[model samples]
Target chain A: MSSNTDFVLSIEDLTVSFDGFKAVDKLNLYVDKNEIRVVIGPNGAGKTTVLDLICGKTRATSGSIKFKDLELTRMSEHQIVRAGVGRKFQNPSIYENLTVFENLEISYPKGRSVFGALAFKRTAEVVARVEEIAREIMLDEFLGTEAGLLSHGQKQWLEIGMLLIQDPELLMLDEPVAGMSARERELTGQLLRRICTNRSVLVIEHDMEFVKNIAHKVTVLHQGKILKEGSMEMVQSDPKVIEVYLGH
Target chain B: MQVAMNKLFGGREGLVGLAILAALIFIIMPLTFDIFRLNLVGKYLTYAFVAIGLVLCWGYGGILSLGQGMFFGLGGYCMAMFLKLESSSPESTKIQSTPGIPDFMDWNQLTALPWFWEPFHSLSFSLVAVIAVPCIFAFIISVAMFKRRVGGVYFAIITQAIALILTILIIGQQGYTGGINGITDLRTLKGWDIRTDEAKYVLYFLNGALLIGCILVGRLIITSKLGRLLLAMRDREDRVRFSGYDVSSFKVFVFCVGAMMSAIGGAMFTLQVGFMSPSFVGIVPSIEMVIFAAVGGRMSLIGAVYGALIVNFAKTFFSESFPALWLFLMGGLFIAVVMLFPNGLAGIYTSYIKPRIDAWIQGRRGGGNLTPTVPAEPQDPVSPRTAERTPASAASRSLAAGIQSEPSRS
Candidate 1:
């Protein structure tokens, strides 16, 4: 009955269906400010769908998603993004045809409108910001490198850098370390921990070891619903979580 | 100063390309061809306007519109209607039943001018309609399709279908649209006889100047942040959307720009060719216009102009000599260009010729002080042979080099 305004993101009984099957069903989640919440699930647990529902990539059949008291359910994807909810896709989705600097500049959150983009100048402020983000993502040297030529790990970082430039209040990263090398995965964990200090981060990750390193709290999703939620140690030890997901 | 100039054009390569194109259109072609041949070249240059537009829409924005001819036809018809009305004055058409109406309308037994055609009596209104009509139509189509997220092959088919529908409508409405023959016998423009050799020369120069202006405008767009966003959106629409952009609005804007450009070409066509017809407003001509963009290197504005000139010149050459083989040859050229040099002439230049020229230039510089020029090389890490396969990357590599080198300078 009572909704919490203190939380950065509050999702109450969110449900989404395709045909007759519910991909995300009656899910209630709340993310606190400056918290790193990791969602772990086996295949078909609707972890990605939960992110989609929040980012407005998929419409919910019922329930509400509130970001800082703003109803994200009624907004379009871009509007939701502009409202400070940034989503990174499962794959590394950088613009291959552009340079790394351009990839970062495109996501700088300025000149987003049609006319704005046309009139957008590469001001020193913009260039300085782009350079800062590129450095944070460990891609300062590759500014002129064609994004398509980057390694899989670099591309993933570039996508994260893209989201960082927007500086979204609530960040949703879908499998940030998937297909990454062990070194890359560790660096990503460090990157995640550093970046989440200023804003809430909702990560959908499958790797348990990586999850332990970055998760302030862990939520186990099973069949469109949360099976367990607690600290990483608590969720790892939960029998239901083990049987449904971690056991595999 | 050099950086500012590079920014104004695409880069040094872009400036050279523009200069070469200007020479061909303004100096070489004018000096070589007689008025009749030059008029035909001017007509082809009008199509260059449409091709340049396609470079932005289809090449950069990644929205393939196969119905450019419809906009071109609309623009040409607007100009034609004004010319037709001017030529159809009471004294000129006194023998017809309706002394002040177009001959085709009078022949079809129409007693008065259609309400739609009434505004064409004013030169200013017709001139505005030449761009406005097609842009409004393009805006509607882009919004309807792009808002629904329909794209790629489906979008192309829908545009082609619209072109066909417009052609059929023009043909069926014999009374209103001059039927399949279109609005013809255009004699004067503001009481100036446009059929004279002097008028032809003036119109040819005007069309050339306009095409160059359009290319410059296209260059401005391609070098802007918007152009980079278009490239980004084409590759990753979701990424751009999540970056807080209304993707459909950009698509609609570029499509409308493309439509406006095609309309200008059409109006110029009517002025230069002395007619506007359904043949140039249908599916075949629409696809042909796309080929012009494709063959010219869809990614290159200057290349599109050259593409229009090359393809149309071949069409005239083949059709004049071996009329039966022209169609087959045209098809073969399209196939060969797509398969071999996918980036068109611009691709060939960037991938093969430009690099060789660059290497020679470097060689001539005695390989000393390679550091300044080496910045351009790192942007394109791939070998020239590999770059040849993905010509767009090679073209954009230089573009990126120009852009990346800016912050350092400042």
Candidate 2:
């Protein structure tokens, strides 16, 4: 992705500290429209903190976070979402008491009017959309199952589908495949590729192989700062990346 | 057909219908029986309305309010005070002669009704007063408390203090308030004779209608996006805050709604019992309301109604029959239910009754399989700071990814 490409989000000098411990420091990055950007880091390298800051989960200590020219640092998480940024927390947050289909329905931006959730009849389009998302995530068969009953990976997929239904312009996922089986991980990778076809995706993952599989560009974070930002090969060849992962 | 029927009769609709049915029986059975039975059922329906509010506040919203009785009392006293005034003629009556005044007010020798008591003379004013007073009180207190970010035990204690203060204030103002005997000798509602069976029936029907309206409103709100936000408030309040919801606003909304419902219940109680006193609006009544919901099931709306009816029925039964042991039995029952069925009577019935009924129809009945499954015990307590990082690891490895949410930091 070139600098001239329409960027969905730009983070400049983003600094977030917890109790004097700097978790994210002066980070600058931009996610180009319809591009897949992977953020890789060792534990405590502030990858999740970046996503958290973008989604308004954590207030940036000092920073400029712009999504399509709208300032996101001052907005609430839901407002950020409404402003077209969707996030999938590392751990699934689907309503357990609700059915799988109901979970997806709640996340649909247009389908959440007070009357709509309780009394609104599911249109054929809604049914089709839900089924389509479920089918893509291999969850079509489990539509009737309670979301509480889904496997770990399936829950993650359902959550991702939820974000998709919201139709956010930028999707930020934190360790989306953290606990998935190999098969489920591969499916998630494919799902990310499909999602990246339309909207910008900033994925934070610890797994280098997973990053290499889905990343169009990889940014390596070490000690709360971006150490490297380049193609997968370039980032993999970076000495800091090897030192953080293997040596120091 | 099966699914449709199941949906209709298996969930909230079914419970609400049952509540309406109980209300109907209360209204009609009085005609079939004597006024004594009529009054009893009428009073029960009033309590049922109170329980419905408790359901929303405690059961779903996860706020175990111990001050609902204060709100209830606010409404009750509003009505009772008005009724006392209406009953009192300009010329001193015989009841006023007792202790040289109405018994509770004898000490004060109150020659004139207080300025606050003047408007309550009209039935409409008193009726509106019942709902409004409690709501305003709740609105003010909740705003103060929630703004300071008080929650959990502190919230519960502050509410308890409010109830206590109101109770004491009412008790001390015997001249203005009815005090210990509260306000009794209520004869009519406005121009209509409350002694009439039709009058009692109207009150009963209104109670039923109000309950239904409340349930519907609660249903609409809880099932909406706001409901999700409320539930999220219970699970991850900070997350919800960061999600951009004004947490204080949501808390106040729930508190006001709960207070209004209790006030409505109190108004009904005054009409049914023809009296209201400080005792009814104290800590004991508040705790009883909580117990009613807890015994039914804290997480389920229908369970609150069931718990209210069952617990109240037991109170009526045991108090009359085994007076000395009634409290003992109530305590025992609470302990037993908490230990045996942490989810409460609803869970017990689900595990025990429904299965047995199904088995009997299938001709493979077994009553022994009724032990309720205990909800997973609270995960070993983790400090808030540690708790934050634990979700990353705990969720990274779990059989039940969806069920085991990290206990929220309040």
Candidate 3:
């Protein structure tokens, strides 16, 4: 189905199966520009798999994932990222060996080619951008901190800052606040809202309160299929969504 | 611009590494040993090429290719082919049944030169092939494996298999490849007799210079963003790929660069040793090359040269005096190096020697008080091998060397 031009990411009839079992079955979803969408489901309901499929980490057995005019199913992970899409892993995947500043700098989008990377310089513009993202993610003070030394909440924020550094048009994060303290979850909710002002944010989270606080719209998946799609209140009110996901 | 270049050249660790290598090549070995022994040191430096390349591919890129000797052999064979062709000139080999063909080819009852050996008639072609062949081979292997998402042990296994295949192919095609004896008895390079003592000294210095050049190239790659990308890619492959870098392409490029480095070493080895044989091309030598990188800090390119020379020197020293115990000693050295100091000799220097050296330099400058900005991490204690050696005015700016030297400490 052709979603409106405002929708930056649209999936049509996406299906992927491992051996005889289908992980994602005929899933269709779309998110508009600057809209923060969250997909929530019980475990094994293919919540994370959707992000994987969108990011080209998991190959779609058969489907079309269109980011604007581009068909992402055919592209590789790096190509998809270059095409203005960024995905964060469920676990914080920040570089522990490098400092927070270096981690953010590496993820910045200006230089990806081998030669480009060799000649890359850290200009004032880049430093200002990294600092700005760090401030947004509340990691500005920890710029010199080795990422491995960061608290679990700071590491999670740092990962978000890394994605922000790339400034992807459509950012996808899986379980952004799964292990955060209550204060961290609150700050992350606000951070997601602030970052989504210019682009799209797709989050997969189990923390209902955090998801409700941030998501403009919610999609519920059950058995690799969309079970409900509506505003957070409407989705929560649905008996089927409540039975499969929210009731837990 | 100045700061970036300093880090790129290995800064303090690099300065220390360069200083040590210079001492070994130009000063210590030259002064202590006669020309004969110095030439032997030249022989060990060739492997330093392979080891330094390993620092790029295995240590930094994290691709443990157990087939570096394949590239080295190919490069050496190219040079050997050129030398062999020159030595087997129509005038020199008039006694042979085929006047123009190499002696080994003639001995194997070949009436005509093999089609593959036809290109060796041009020294230019042989020279190009020395770098091109190994790089092309590495490109093929890396593209096939890395593109397919095959790495770690599987990639290592495949590379080892490639080494096996090459050795078998070279040996089995005895007529074409000079058999297990390999391309040997190489004499002159275009009428310049390589066997002369004068030529030996020239080749030795040339080899040392090329080794330094390769170290600089390694420094260039590792210090640049591409180098940091290699470190990031190794630690978090998906993160890098997701960061919009083509991970496989980076892998292929570094692998090719490493292969090219080894080929130069091989060409130099052919020049210095006067022969290229299967002894240097087989699975054992291939694995032995990895030990050179490991015995040096795999992450430290300068450490790699020292690693290669030290290991080879020890090998020669032990095998000469206690021939029966040499193998056991090598085995123990490798095991002990791996178990006790996984970071190798460079690790010891950085952790212990470099810090003390830094303190001595700093203590002299600022009356017994090390700067507070330094020692952010107690474990990574070292700096300014450059500043220590050079005058304070130019060297003061090189404390950036501390960060560069500290890259692999973690």
- Give lDDT per model, in order: 0.88, 0.72, 0.84
lDDT of 2 at B43: 77
Please state the CAPRI-style docking class of candidate 2.
Answer: incorrect
Winner on DockQ between 1 and 2 is 1
Q: How do all the candidates rank in terms of TM-score, highest first?
A: 1, 3, 2
Measured on C-alpha atoms, candidate 3 has an lDDT of 0.84
Q: Please, what are the lDDT tens digits per residue for candidate 1 over residues B209-317?
A: 9998898888778777788888888989999998999999999999999999999999999999999999999998998999999999989888898899999999998
Measured by DockQ, the strongest candidate is: 1
Give the TM-scores of the predictions, in the order they appear: 0.94, 0.81, 0.93
Arrange candidates by DockQ, descending: 1, 3, 2
What CA root-mean-square deviation does each model show from the true structure?
4.4, 8.2, 4.8
Checking candidate 2 for backbone clashes, the offending pairs are none
> What lDDT tens digits, residue by residue, belong to model 2 across residues B177-258?
8767688878766667776777876776676677666666665555445565566567656534533346677778778888
Q: Give the CA lDDT, 0 to 100, for residue A212 in model 2.
A: 87
Per-residue C-alpha lDDT of model 3 across residues A1-248, encoded as one tens digit per residue: 56556679989999999996999999999888889999988999998999999999999999889999899999989899999999999999988766677789899898899889888877788788888888988877667655666778788889888988888999999999988889888888888888888899999999888888988999998989999999999998999887877787
Candidate 1 Cα errors over 4 Å, as ranges: B1-4, B367-376, B379-410
Which docking band does candidate 3 fall into? medium
| Candidate 3 positional error at A137, Å | 1.9
Q: Across residues A1-248, which tens digit of lDDT does each residue of candidate 1 receive? A: 55899999999999999997998889999999999999999999899989988888889999999998899999999999999999999999999767787889889988989889988877789889998998999988788777776788899999999999999999999999999999999999989988987899999998889999999999999999999999999998999988877787
